[model samples]
Target: MRILKTRQYELVEAKDIPDPFPPYAILSHMWLSPKEEITYQDFKSRKEDIENDVYKQTGWAKLKRYCDRAARDGWDWAWMDTCCIDKTNPADTQEAINAMFRWYQNASICYAYLGDVDAYGSLEEAGLIDQDHPMNEDLDEMPGMIPVPGAATNHMRTAVGRSLVNAKWFTRGWTLQELLAPRYLVFMDKSWHRIGTRESWAAEINEASRIEPKHLTTFKPTDFTSCSIAMRMSWASSRYTTVEEDETYSLLGLFGISLPLIYGEGRWRAFDRLQRELIMVYTDDSIFAWKLSETNQGFIRLQRQGQKPGLGILAPSIREFRDASQIQSFGYYGHKFEMSNLGLKTNARRWKCHNDHTKLLIRLNCGPEPKAHTGIMLRYAGEVFERIMDSELHDTRNFERSRDWIGVQEKEGKDIIIRAGNFRGPLTGPSIFTLRHPDEITVGLKYFMDFNVPLMSRKLELLDEVSLLGRLQLQRNELLLQPNQLMFANIELQTGEHQSRWNVLININENGFPSVGMASQEDRGKQLGDPMSEAKRKYENLAEDFHDQAQSEGCLPLIVETKQGISVNVHLFPRPPRERSSETTRDGEVYIEMREYTLKIIGKEKKDLNGSKQPQSSS
Candidate 1:
């Protein structure tokens, strides 16, 4: 460990642990810009370099004032990062990073400097704070110095409280350990003036860092890595490091790992190594509980498991675990994961998704409760299992209470190795979709309409353009449906001698959203009375239906599954209304709506809609 002689500005090297070390103050802060900071090499040449008023700059001023503050408290030694370690030497840098947590832990006191915050807040009475004020003196000899003990009074708290809430010190990658490992810490503003001690400002720190008050104030070394890895990663999700690799490097001490540091490896690769290290050492399966943050797109919006892109078992970044800080881990003991050239292999319960063979859920051994387990969405790809994070088809708000289709059942224990690091072979996936619409309707006709059909991927076109089961008269229907799910148009079905007359109504609103709904023979009859009534209903534009179309009358989802079981889910987007006009017949009857006719034929692995091929859109 290296310490600075505060009184003489001399670097003192302590090669071995001093039996009874002198009390030393440590500085915990983000580094200034490159040109502003004083490095260890800068001090090796001359003792007079800091004199001649050359150390008046912000970076030098911070160090000088910190030393002054330590000396003011009657301590002769103080330590800081910027000028302490010789970073140019790789071995020295590595050892320093590995021991940083302990260095902070052993400190008698730590000064947390927030460069973006000010001790004096904006005064409403005056426009702005005057630059020339009794700020903390930059050197011990400077006049009009701020008081030392109990300096942050009620006026300082009122001024510094709001600024502390969003201090940049709380959002830096390395500060996480600095904030937790220190025995005693005090927050200092930009001018190095005392704001408050860590104990007195625990609430403000908790509000800023999302760390519990106890974690900030208590000296609990045993409790450091007891938290789940996912929870620890979440704390740094919103934080940033100047060099991205430091994101993983700074967290080494927090996880109790001492692997050699690779400064230039990309962030994800570093994180990948860290995760692999963690898996080898600990049984916390909470590492797998991350998902992308929530968004506006919700229920019924489906994307087939095959259509969505695949992910490795590991998350790409810490940000993916945004809301995972509070979750607890039950531990995945007894299930030892083995990593090989193939990938990570583990034996655990693999539950099949209801009615969907391609999709499965892997249990996570952590959640709010033991029985309340969370499952990550996984799909069986060409030769290996891949994770699914982009598709809403598998999205579940609460895994504990998700629907059967969204949840998993029928668990079978299997030892599977998901493809990851071994990427010499292709991470295989198929690019094919087949949509088939049945001409005949059955009692489970809604199932046909919602799944294994082309209804979901139908292309919109004028009714006069294509020919299908021709439009039929309503005869006598009297149901007045909402604008969202009104019976807009119809396609006649096979009316066999044994079968009752049945038809499927397709609703295409002005926003271009399509709904394939099947009403019962009785319900269909009560919709529109005659052909004239149908034309009138269509001519009316049914603008009222577009007002608040939450319930799509008999809206059934369209899931297109091919012969090979590759599914294609239609993302029905309600876009802005487009200008539309219909044709009027010679008999004084005008065309009311349009039906998108998408004809698809299954190819070897892919399919062609009609003679031409079509691709489905994603949400």
Candidate 2:
């Protein structure tokens, strides 16, 4: 990233710049960029003139909206030359140009305002000024500088002058190199084309070409008539542009291919203008070969790597009106109707005749023989049938717009009925229809099954309509099937209402809880068929085994135990819950009685029978 050392210069204010004269109206407002810097000396030099210029200061309000939007967007910042950079000094201007490449590289995006597409003036018109001006005599017929009141005379002959004039195509607010180097460029007007203004001027070359044809020459003023005729003939097969072709051609070189016709029309002209005239398209991968017509004959030939050559006829012509329409046919005396092979000088089967209005006839070679067939025919039915449907899938009386359906007949043997929004009229050629949800989906389902019903020859239409139907149906289903929502399925019994093409229900012979067949040993071995009961039994047994292990691990009780006291035939019965709690709390203190008992004997066993305590503590 090369940057110029910042010079120790005074910062100049934007108000100080000299204003352009009244006759020279600004086509586009200026902007400043963060990439540039300004100085005091620069501002002071232009301050007096800029302050006096009423138009620059007064009309600034018009730019407020644009400035506000740009600021909000963040992608674009103001980069107007007048406001953004200090251009008063020659050193500053030179430094700015040198730093342009780095500046553009750093920018996220470039906004190229083409201004008004129609507001452009020709180079000749830009030079025009009134003969009655006070300094008219002092100024040359061409572009030149005249004396200013408080500032040095600004001349158009300088290198900077050339840049200012040529810059309108790219560099005015930006240098040409800077404009080209940006990461991305957005044209403000969607329709603004970088191609040259006139169909002829656009054809000029901005870059060099590699494989330029040997016999090619530049275009002259005389090639218009033949080119137009050629274009009308081939218009059906190819997409050609009448606007100048050179700019696109020049930009192509950035991709990496080279165009060779960087030389002049004749061998005698200087090479400098020649380099600027012819188009050179080079790309990173593919190389396209081009051949220009000799003697300014208004034609170009383009050929891709593996395809047959194509011809591009240029408008504006010279003499020797050759038929630019179709490639010349074969034979020595002139074979206008038949195709001749210029490369092989023999008859070729690939060539076929085509007419603008007539149905296209194509002939192909098949296995050493030629087979002929008539293609599908789709003709307009001359009337459009329209209808509208409601949410209930019933028809509603709506405005019927008619459009010609091509060879289509509805159930009534009339033109296929198409229902859309407010339009109900005859439609032919190309027409678009907009429809709401259910109708769109219903139509899509119908078309998906039998699109041939709408036309003699089928071509798919209504993709957006089909997509809308899907979205609408999904939304409806979502609403219908909400959580805990109740819905009814219309079910019919087999013997009653279920006998139809779509649904079937069967009744079993043996009923009453649906008998689970029990298999006997004889039935199992003798092929009578084992019962499902056998499988269920095995499953239950396995489940019990698993449950036992699980219960033991989980501290679950699987057995009950009873303990007996045996000394001298004394027996005690279990106490109830209330009695046990009372006994456990007999001491007037809270206590928990153990559900399981642990034995500890301290009294004599004989006391139980006697109902009194004997001397023996235990038996």
Candidate 3:
């Protein structure tokens, strides 16, 4: 560490100071533009000439004045960030960054200079023109005369206060630790006038920075460990750094951990490394409890293919840790833990849905609590398995709590193992069993399916134009193609055995398949009758037509070409109603309701030109 001798205004190495180092003050301020701030080389070469040249630059002038003030206050030295460290040396830069918090904490006092604020001018202008004063009652009637408030008291709502709140000093990432680490920090305006101390300005600072009052008032290095990782991350959310990697590097001291600084490692990798180091030193599940936004889902999908070590279910960026209160609610207590390949293992009980198919509900062993029985919805896509919550499965707020699904407690264990299902059908290495915090995992599996299906279909359209064109021809022949020219399945429901056909408009849902009868048509509005029987007949006819068309074209009609030129089978099925009813309408008029038809794109399958089955693509 290097300290500046206040009397001489020259940089002095810490080693040069005797075994018993003298007390020193520290300058905490935002850096000036590169051209104006003095560097280490400039200070070294022009040590004597600096005093004369420094006055031209605001930053150097402030530093000189800060040193002079410290000297007059009985301090031997002062440290300013702009010229104190030899930034050209990598080792020095790294060490300084790691030790910055400690330096601030050890300082006799910290002078926070706000260059934008004019302390004297603002205080005088506001203090002399108080509208609430009794003298101001007839001030409008008098010319060039106004009531003035006393200048003896300090008010935060004055012009000086506004300048202090909006200062750039409060928005820098490095300044966050600086603000918290110092024992006594004095806010000084452009004229070097003292505005307030940390204690006197705590409330205003907290309001401006959105930091918790306790953190601003009584901060310590230990405070980092006492709070949830999400809360700590939230404090840095609105703060910024000049170098992208410094956003993570600057927080090392606050987190009480340090790793070699790799400047080029981008923000994503830097944050990932930071979280990895944090998890190694602290066992807090809330560290991984980050809220997912709509944009974050895309990142999760990108990483779903293959995740890195120590990154199990962790969000890629700090932006996800937005809510500090939500993270603190978990109250996870543990210091040492490890992540296992198997997560939250449980025995699944099969339950029937309206479709008559069984869905698995995995019973989780949540610690020793007897009444805390929780079940997560288990879904399987080939060998990959996923765990979802009950809240994510359906809109259950209006319905009674059923045995179908339940929420899991986050304090169960560090590494919870979840069994995929009963049949150990072809285990694909180690299955990824992930269970995110309930508040963080808002969107269910249906959301991802909804978001990706259309993209997949569009990609398929681009990749397999030939197959899409063939499908288009079939749609055109049936007049099922919309006016927009998009290919869709036609649902022709036959009623009354007279072969009366009602043309049901098809809609492409988030699932990427054409569905019909979800919305009643104006022409069919008055015809109110159950159309399940007619829908069943229409499905059978469509299935027959599909098979015959496949046979004639020497290619499966169900097989659609993907963007990668892979053939995927599309299945048409009837969607079960929320509640089944057999009662016909009072007038006995038959009508088709929307949402009757459902479509799904299954796994890829290849078929030869001769209609013989061929090998499918791995993807």
RMSD of each: 17.4, 33.5, 17.8
lDDT score, candidate 3, position 59: 60
lDDT of each: 0.57, 0.23, 0.51
The residue pairs in collision within model 1 are 477-525, 477-526, 477-527, 478-526, 478-527, 479-526, 483-545, 599-609, 599-610, 600-609
Predict model 2's lDDT versus the native. 0.23
Tens-place lDDT digits, model 2, residues 378-495:
1121232111111111011110111221211123232121111121111111111121211101111111111112224322221233454354332221111111111111111121
Give lDDT tens digits, candidate 1, residues 365-395: 6765555666677788876787765432222
Work out the TM-score per prediction. 0.59, 0.20, 0.55
Show where candidate 3 strays beyond 4 Å: 51-55, 124-159, 223-226, 293-312, 329-336, 339-402, 407-414, 417-619
Model 2: per-residue Cα lDDT at residue 557 = 23
List ranges where model 1 is wrong by over 4 Å: 15-19, 51-53, 122-158, 218-226, 293-309, 332-336, 369-371, 390-411, 421-619
Counting clashing residue pairs in each candidate, in order, gives 10, 52, 16
* Model 3 agreement with the true structure over 545-580: per-residue lDDT tens digits: 332343344322343343333343434555454332
- Runs of candidate 2 with Cα error greater than 4 angstroms are 1-44, 48-53, 57-69, 72-77, 81-102, 117-288, 293-619
